[model samples]
Target: LFGYVLILVLVTFDYKELAPLGYILYGIVILLLIYTGLFVHTIAGTQRWINLGFFHLQPSEPAKLAVVIVLASYYSNHDTEDGYRLRDIIRPAILTAVPFVLIMMQPDLGTALMLGILFVSMTLFVKLRWSTISILGTVAMGGAFIGWKFLLKDYQRRRIETFLNPEGDPMNHGYQIMQSKIAVGSGQVFGKGFLEGTQGHLHFLPERHTDFAFSVWAEEWGFVGSVFFLGCYFFLLLWGINIAMTARDKFGVLLAFGLVMLIFWQAVINLFMIMGFLPVVGIPLPLFSYGGSSLLTTLISIGILMNIRMRRYQIKT
Candidate 1:
């Protein structure tokens, strides 16, 4: 209901109004992330949220929006017909890296990855010289290697190691993935019916209401229903992509596409993690997962998409 209300409220505003405030908003989120990381009490082994009495607020979630808007604001105003020089992206990279570093300090790997991906996705849309793309790609690969080898914490590395060999640690790191697979396999075709899933109802699936919400959904809905749900997600992505393509200005295009990618990768990673194809990262599935911060950010992104769609007739170009 709050999500719906957010969409209704934001859709009525002009997206263009946000252009000037992008950097300011981005800076504000950065400060919030720093405060959360340093001062907020740790919960479940991480200090990722601020205690707001009624509800804990996760600053990193909204940082996704801040980064997207600020990047779009920069790109829309200054663009080149020919491919950009490699040096041109430094500003945007720095803009993205600030929040990335802050969130990483919170030790929230999932949101940090999302920010990095958001930057890369938005950059890809811009026409870049082949040499520049090659250099950046190589740099990205090297960064990943260094991140895995030195930056990842002991438990984080164990998660990936366990993903490779689940049988090695069935009772510890590997437990969740193994159980997730069983639940998925148990939901053969038509499912066991709503609220009747043994895995979820029996409380056998850990984090069933949050990170593994899809597992609960699949265990109850079966393969057919799972397919239907996934199809809807696919349609939403395609629809948002179409909106990005048809957007009147470059900012709208970037904003719409960036927001969609933000939601897209989260869903993809969550589903793959649940199915044992990837290591479990605590990324929540948009709308489907029970998280106040994620749901609010997702709805705001949807609202921005609607804002872009409604104002398409007012082409800036």
Candidate 2:
């Protein structure tokens, strides 16, 4: 509900000119994402978010929902008794490709990777056959290799290279990851106490209130706070999974599952990235992060979950 409202407002304001065309929404989004990547939010040489005076919006955030809706709607109506046919996989392949390409074009390797994860999870949930999945997986891998060899922009390649050897560029490409580790280690169980974190206060951590926000919490609240935060995430995931299981229909079920995967995968990945357990792909920490776009999109997704839950018991007369 809130997500829809926010989308409405975004369309009403920033995208007003394109809203009436409807057909152009996707193009507009892609174009703006490209523009931001090339010019607006080129920090660390990856273009993901766009800074509007009032808010920093991530076009990829809504793109995730869009992909989920298209997939859920298709799977809900299709028959899969004989297992997923090539055509069934093709439909979703195309669905996942557009956003994946656009986001990758933004050079947001992390979010793009998340989209790939979403695709695989949703496809598996739809009961696509192992043989079919294997064939498709191989092709996808081949395509990714081709993209890496031919499609990836230079900086993106560099990010991968740096990930392979963080120590090779500790003061440059690896600084964020290295500093993040230091901050987490410095917390020492109970944390340095709120607002007293030297790393964050001294600005040693980049994007502290956004992508690295978990580090901020960990620094201030320490290991105990980290556990509590993880607990909240655990509760949320369980709650969403419960909703998925109890959904009244296949559409509701798939929709809930997609939402669950989106939230769960992203939360786990972001947390891990900040803890130096994973590469810095620049995924955000959801509600606790300071991005309006992410917060709005997350709340809206919850609204969709609520919508499914509320109507679960109300059969039509």
Candidate 3:
């Protein structure tokens, strides 16, 4: 809802026009969605999508909801012999792996990492034993390390290394982070004023309309506006948590919690990355970024939350 509205606003004000390439963009998004499920075998390198000249769509985005629904449905029907058996864990793990493997192929390390976090959070909520958690954690960490060393592309490694020492590569990989910091720092307490940001207007900050949208806000609105934006997110998070707490079933609660965590954690990680507090992970600020795919996915996720909330109050009996 918010995404569609924001896009309309952008188009209305002529702030950003999409009509010229809208058809191509929509065509690609549709193709990517179809390919992700039907042609998983043919998908190479990244599990994201097949670019069709116009736009690139990520099926993994919706796959997140599918995994949640499938996992929730399974748990809703099944009973554990002792806490949660190995099979119980394996089923959900397999469900998560299908999409995780696909998205990782896109080489979208950020979304893949988010999916990993979602899996861990949901599994923990399922009441896995400490021993199992420990074993899984160790294995996951080791696999990640191996992936970093062997599977990750050269540029990806540079992102991590650059995050650690951004100043070392001011003109290359670090340029985005450095410019982001300058934009944020320049805002100080108040801000430079809307559409008046030198960094943003001058194109010094890369992805200004997308991943680094927050920097545009910070550079213009300053600390006050930034806090306001965060407050809205805070409201959304708290409301989602409240919905989970009052949910009639464990499945509803876990699904709501998992979704909330997904959004909240993404926001935190993205903001931290843009602020130079963490490595640049290419995670976009939800609702505020310009990508149509991301915007639509986030809105649909919120719609799912609304559906859960509305239905949660009705007694099945």
lDDT of 2 by residue, 1-317 (tens): 45567544442332112213333444566667667666774666566777777777888887777777667777877857889977777877887888788788767777788888898899889877778978987998898899889877776677667766777999888888888888888897999897999999999998998999988888888899889999999999999998899877787788889988999998989988876677777788878887777888687677777666766675643
Global Cα RMSD, each model:
1.3, 4.9, 8.1
Q: Estimate each model's TM-score.
A: 0.97, 0.85, 0.83
Candidate 3 segments whose C-alpha is farther than 4 A from its true place = 1-56, 79-82
> Model 2: residues >4 Å from true position, as ranges?
1-56
Q: What's the lDDT of the predicted structure labeled candidate 3?
A: 0.74
Q: Give the TM-score of candidate 1.
A: 0.97
lDDT of each: 0.89, 0.78, 0.74
Kindly give the stretch of ten consecutive residues in candidate 3 with the minimal lDDT sum: 11-20
Model 1 per-residue lDDT tens digits across residues 1-317: 87789899988878988888877888889889889877888877888978789777899999999999988998888799888778988899999999888887778888898899999999988888899899999999999999888777788889989999988999999999988988888888988889999988898889999888898888888999999999999999998999999998888999999999998999999999999999987899998999899999999899999999999888464
lDDT of 3 by residue, 11-46 (tens): 233201222333344344345645764674445444
TM-score comparison, 1 vs 2, better candidate = 1
Scored by lDDT, the top model is 1
Please give the lDDT score at residue 24 for candidate 2.
47
Q: Rate residue 171 of model 2 by lDDT.
A: 89
Residue 221 shift from truth in candidate 1, angstroms: 1.0
